[model samples]
Target: MNREPLVSVIVAVYNQERFIGRCLRSLLHQTLSSEKYEIIVIDDASTDRTSYALELFHDAIRPVANARNLGLAASVNRGIDVARGSYIVRVDSDDYVNANFLHMLSIFLEMNGYVDAVACDYLLVDDGENVIERVDCSERPIACGIMFRKEQLIDIGLYDESFRCHEDRDLRIRFDKKYRVYRLELPLYRYRRHDSNITNNAEAMRQHEANLIRKHGLDLAASNGMS
Candidate 1:
């Protein structure tokens, strides 16, 4: 009998052929036993050799190839829809993590059941994997490097499909309303900063930021008691 995984790590990819292999290898080498976790890789209709790179790990990961490009939000949601784990986490195809990343986060969540989610500090890195600076998740929470109880995510309606960028902020708003995200303050995850980063798109980010502010402005303001 095959026991269900305790954690589901969703690796969302676009056209990251250069980094996908390393990302997958990092997850595969986690200190957490293979049987205790599952890795789901969703390719968002990449035009590069990303698909071929994924093919190399077909046996190690559960792969999903979208017929069309649906952006990050949709791809993440798709991964969640099919996830079969008690806890859920995400790792971008362009990024990787330390060996104990999953083990530590999952253990923390298991021991502290009162928390809705657990996040760790991450190191921002260049394309060559050189450390740029360590980001304190206590100050700003990025999308990755966090683990959430699957049920809690479902209750909050998961990631908003309407958002292409800053979806993490939007979800955080809704998530903070009912529960809290605890930061471990440990540099366990690596965040890649490259020239092709989607956030570099100034106009798209501006439009999405405005859209998020518009959609949840009233709620956010009301929560802060701004009248």
Candidate 2:
């Protein structure tokens, strides 16, 4: 591990023992050379056997355990702080990716130096890994699948920890103001939908959405009025 990795994949997990194994497996089996990328898993004080699952791949990953549940944004920020790669990306513990995920995205960044970040399309999958739909990330963006320059992320300041929900949205808004995120139309990421998804909580999503709108001074009503 003497040479610096080209990319760092940060995984933030909370009680996702059932699917984390699959997620890590996909990352481990990436087409990208093993030495070119690093995997960092943040265990956000899960009350389940997630830690045990992490231990199974102890030799392959760098594990960081939080003493208490610090929410998603905070955990991601922690990962970013410790990452040594030139580029970084988040892969949720419940979702996995294609073998070419890292290689494709990293190559895109390498070839296009002006682009601050790049995101790929993804497939919506059920718990049984059945494909539901192929989603265009630019139209319906999610937290994962986007590879960003580590320095650019630090330049704009990291994720807003106050946002427990829609934190990705919040980060994107700020990121877009100063940098560009291009889209690579490839369904390389698999986003798993389940009953336990945080987005399932309508009330929390609403509160966070309102907070984001106000924080950014977005005039949603006016923008919609023209339509």
Candidate 3:
């Protein structure tokens, strides 16, 4: 018999053949014990060798292949549906994290009874792994580097599948309203910025941002931070 995993790390991928291997490798190398965490990789109907790359880690990761491309939010939701852990963390396939990422975040959550979630500082890197800038996440933190209590997120309805964009901000809005998300100053995550990033679709993102504002019924002033 095996012990239940303490954390479920969800990695959502979409045609990330070039980076998925490195991402999975980084995860496999986490300082956290293998038995302590479960890696759930949701492949969003990749057309490239992303699936093949993931297959290489068959023993380490539980792969979920989408029949069709359901996009990021839906893919994440799918992973959450099957996740079996006390805590949940989201990491994009194109991005990778430091070895101590899980140990730091998980221990913090376990110790801080008041904090519902925790996020960490991240380095914004290009495809070449060159540092673009360091996002201390001084203001609004990103959804990827944060770890949330599984029950808390499930109670809040997980990721909004309807939101193809601004899903993180939408969840944060509702999450912050009920629970607190603490920021760890340590740079434990490496956020990769590339042309394929969905944020590059300005028009689509703007439309989604509008939809998000409408959904929450916020004024223009408050809408600026929608993403």
Candidate 4:
């Protein structure tokens, strides 16, 4: 009988042909045993060669392709829906991670059952993968490199489909209300910064920021003791 994997690594991709290969390769090279974790890649209707890039790893990953473009939040939610692991982690298709990324994070969670979720520090890199800065996940969190207990995520409700941007922030706000996300303090993830990054779109980010603020305004104010 096949035992279920301990961790499920979700990667959502859209028009990331140029970097998806490297991202998938990094995941395949993890120190964690292959049977211990499963990689789920959701291709969000990429019009580029991203499909071909994903095809190279056809046997190694569980691939899901959307018929139409559903954006990041929806794609991630879909991946979660199909995941069969006890724990979940998201890794953007354009970014990569160190060989120990999964082994370290999963081991921490395995030993610390009380923790609902755990995040690790990451190295920010340019398009060329040069180290720019080592970011503190607790102080400045990004969407990925965080591993959450699957049940905790489901109990809190998954990513909001309404959010085209700042989806991570929206989910984090809701998740933090009930459970705490502990930090690992190790730079195991690599975040790639490039012009095509969604955050670079000031207008979209501004709009989503407003939506997020409105959705959680009361909670935010109370946390800040303004209420």
Candidate 4 at 9: error in angstroms? 0.5
lDDT of 3 at 91: 92
Q: How close is each model in CA RMSD to the real structure? A: 3.1, 2.8, 1.6, 2.9
TM-score of 2: 0.96
Position 7, candidate 2: lDDT:
99
Q: Model 3, range 1-227, lDDT digits (tens) per residue?
A: 99889999999998889999889898889888889999999999999898888889999999998999998999999998999989999998899999999999999999988889999999989999888888876464676989999999988888898989888888887887788888899988999988988889999988988888888867642633722
Q: Which lDDT tens digits does candidate 1 get at residues 76-114?
A: 989999999999999988999999999999999989879
For model 2, how does the per-residue alpha-carbon lDDT over 1-227 read when each residue is reduced to its tens digit?
Answer: 38999999999999999999999999999999999999999999999999999999999999999999999999999999999999999999999999999999999999988889999999999999999999988888888999999999999899999999888877887788889889999999999999999999989988887887788766642221110
| TM-score for candidate 3, residues paired by index | 0.95
* Ranking 1 against 3 by lDDT, winner: 1
Residue by residue across 62-122, what tens digits does model 4's lDDT show?
9999999999999999999999999999999999999999999999999998888999999
lDDT of 1 at 69: 94
Alpha-carbon local distance difference test for all models: 0.89, 0.92, 0.88, 0.92
Task: Tell me the TM-score of each prediction against the true structure.
Answer: 0.95, 0.96, 0.95, 0.96
